[model samples]
Target: MQALQSRLQQLENATGSDIWNILKGSESDLIQDLSTLNTLKEDKEKKGREALKVLETKKKELKSLKKEIETLRNEYKLHVEEVEKGLKASGLEMSQVTKVFEKVLEDSLSEKKTKILQIISSMRDFKTIPELHSPLKSILELLKDPNQEKLRSMIQIDLEDIHRQSMEIFRQNLWSEFQKQGIPMKKLQETPNPDEFLQRVSRIFEFSSDLDLLLIGIPNNRIHVAFGMLSNICIDMIENEKERDADFEWILTSAHKWAKNLREVIEKATERTGSEFDEKFVEFIGNITKRFLKKNQKDPLIFTKLATLLRRFEDTCEFNLTDKDIFESLYEPEFISKWILLEIELFTLSFNQLLLDSSSFDPLPSIFIGSASSSTWASEITVQFEQWISRVEKDISSIRNPEVQTTFYECLYALMIDLCSKIHVEANRLYSEASWSNHVYLVMNTIWELRRIVKVFIFITNRERDRRGKKKDIELAGELKWPRENSFLKEN
Candidate 1:
């Protein structure tokens, strides 16, 4: 057992006997664990290297993507700028083309007519030219050729033929339309007297003539044709006064239809694109006034017609008063003077007639006659005559030049003298009548006042003439002064 103990001690010394041997076994297990850990670390290092290679590849791809995106952005910006330049250039070209088109339309007459017709037809489809896709421009380009005129004239003739056919249908349809509206043909046919109906129809013709001349701007040639027809109708009516009233009514009805047709023709003429007919119409109106004067001679109808014409002139041309052409024509001195003289003559005739027949004198006639004869009776008439005289005086005063003023004054003086002579005759007739005895003192007193005022006016005018030393003015003054001076001396 001692020898066994010694062997065991040697074993213990070799491998740490007694629990040391078990510990040595555990240490071996730990060394094996360390070896396994070292193997795992080496495997982990290999995996790390693989992951680094993948990251490098991904980084290169990302850089390429960023460069591509930048290149694409630059290309897009350049494309947008080029598109904007193209749009601006196109807009400028369109504007230039439009201007060229308008010029062509204005200068080329044949082209204008053709294009206008086309435009009118197109208007049924579209409200405006723009909706027709630069139609005006295209039409203008087509019109640039010289053959457009011949084509236009041919087209016009064809259009007229078509219009004639269409108008027949239109008239028939219009008659039906009128019937549907319940307008009576019998009411339109009612006749007064043959002579009276002729006169009434003449008045309507005159109205239409004036309208055509002053308002519509019809050609002078057309005006002459229309006026001649109207004159013939008037002459026929006057010469055949014994004809049946129905005959006159039929003629008048025909005249109305003719006037309607003429108006339509004038309207069509005016629609021609470059036509300027307003001036011609004005000339035609003047001619009509002259013709009416010639037909009536010195009859009161002449003055009445002239007054009617003046009123029509005012209505038609007043809106264009500021237009230089219209103003010169309307305010011509000779025309105005003639009109004033006619007005004065009308007043004179009516005044003398009223004085001669007091039994038949109405209040209006008496008032007008009395006021015209003497300022003492001015209060008797309506304010209208007084305003008219005041306006006339203002118009006369507006003539600044001495020659015109003197001439106008002389004409007025003649009118005044003629008026005074008529008044004198009326006064003599009234004084001779025994029935006027009760009002005799009042009449004499008014006459005396008027005579005195007239004398005073003459004296003042003479004084002005003497101061001016104008021979014509002096002669007028002496003529007026002698009458009043002699009349006053004779009364005394």
Candidate 2:
């Protein structure tokens, strides 16, 4: 009994449980467990015997498969021998025939490869698409053979090269033809009739249309050269108008009309070729527009012209030319920084002119006293303020990016506040002189008029924004923050 209890304690320790309690329960339970273990041992031995039988059957089938494979190998050897005998009877060996056939195919492809390379090299010398027709057709014929798929792939690179060179040559020729016609000569100047200008422009269309028929079945052969040239001409004319001092309204209208004519000419060309006119023309115009903008970036008048140009394009043309498009083209960090600073220089000139004009004001009429009506000096400054707002709005209304527009508004607000601060400083200087009391009063009235104008400007702009269904986010900043606080300006 002591030995069995010691064994049961060992079992309890090994199992991590008090099995001795269950073991101490009944002898019938122990007898049933022993029966279940015996049954499981028998079942495992039976499964092992069945697995051995399945292994024996698999070994027999594998041995039979080896015999069948040997028979097949013998038959394959006999078939090869018969084929070799047949080749010998025809005065040909398998190895020799294969080498000869491979040589012929290789030589043929090499000759065609040389021809393609020659054609691509001489692409610039070729005058028309017809010059490319016979050689390209012959090379393409070999590409149609199913047996020559490898050969086709060998020349696919050359074919793409040809397409690129050909299109480049086409673009160059189109540009040359535009230059030849003197297309941009006086197109910038106002004319009673533009039909005569477009008539000369129609010559390039004829040239492109003649080649369009020949380029059928050729991939990536759409004629965009004319569109590109037209875009260049339009931009050049725009620059010309600016230099010629043409009317601003005319410049804006002419930009839209230029786009309209561009669309019409492109549509006419695509109709001949049965291809879709993509945004390539817009992109081309954008490139030229960037160059134009950069050239005139130092001139403040370009800003007003560019703004009005964008407005006219959006309002008139279905073509999507957004402010983002124009902004991105001119958005190089250094260029935009210089452009913004240029505005400061322009304002300084205009401000100096205003001061000069005010200096010349007769002392008799410039006299001021405390009254309900605004002083003459205040009236003149407010009128100038209204004009500045109008000019700024020309650019502001054209700015579509909300964040950029807000930044520009802040810039304008800062300029106004700076002007007020300067006036205040001058008033302080006047107050130092006891006889200049009326001058100080006039300057104070000017500040009050500026404040009134700011209020009216905010009200009108908010009403416009509300009508347009945009958020009324325009506001003022300073100690007397009327609409919103500008933390950036406050920091400055």
lDDT scores of the candidates, listed in order: 0.45, 0.57
Tell me the tens digit of each residue's lDDT in model 2 across 64-142: 9999999999999999899889999998898997899889978887776676566556654665655755555555554
Clashing pairs in 2: none
TM-scores, all candidates, are 0.29, 0.52
Could you say which candidate leads in lDDT? 2
Poorly placed runs, candidate 1 (over 4 Å): 1-275, 316-409, 418-440, 448-492
TM-score of 1: 0.29
Clashing pairs in 1: 12-17, 213-281
RMSD per model, one decimal: 31.0, 16.1
lDDT of 2 at 65: 97
The digit string of per-residue lDDT tens for model 1 on 1-492 reads 343344455566464364565555456555666788799989999899999999999999999999999999998988867766775767755456568886775566655666656753653454321343344344445545566665445455544443333333333433333233222222223323434433433433333333232212344333344334444554466456553232433443444444444433334433231223344334434444444444444453344333443544445442223332322332356555564676577556655554565432222333432344455342221223344344445454433345555665566567556645544555456667787564444444444444454455455555655555643432222222212322522332
Which whole-number lDDT from 0 to 100 does residue 350 have in model 2?
69
After superposition of all CA atoms, the RMSD between model 2 and the true structure is 16.1
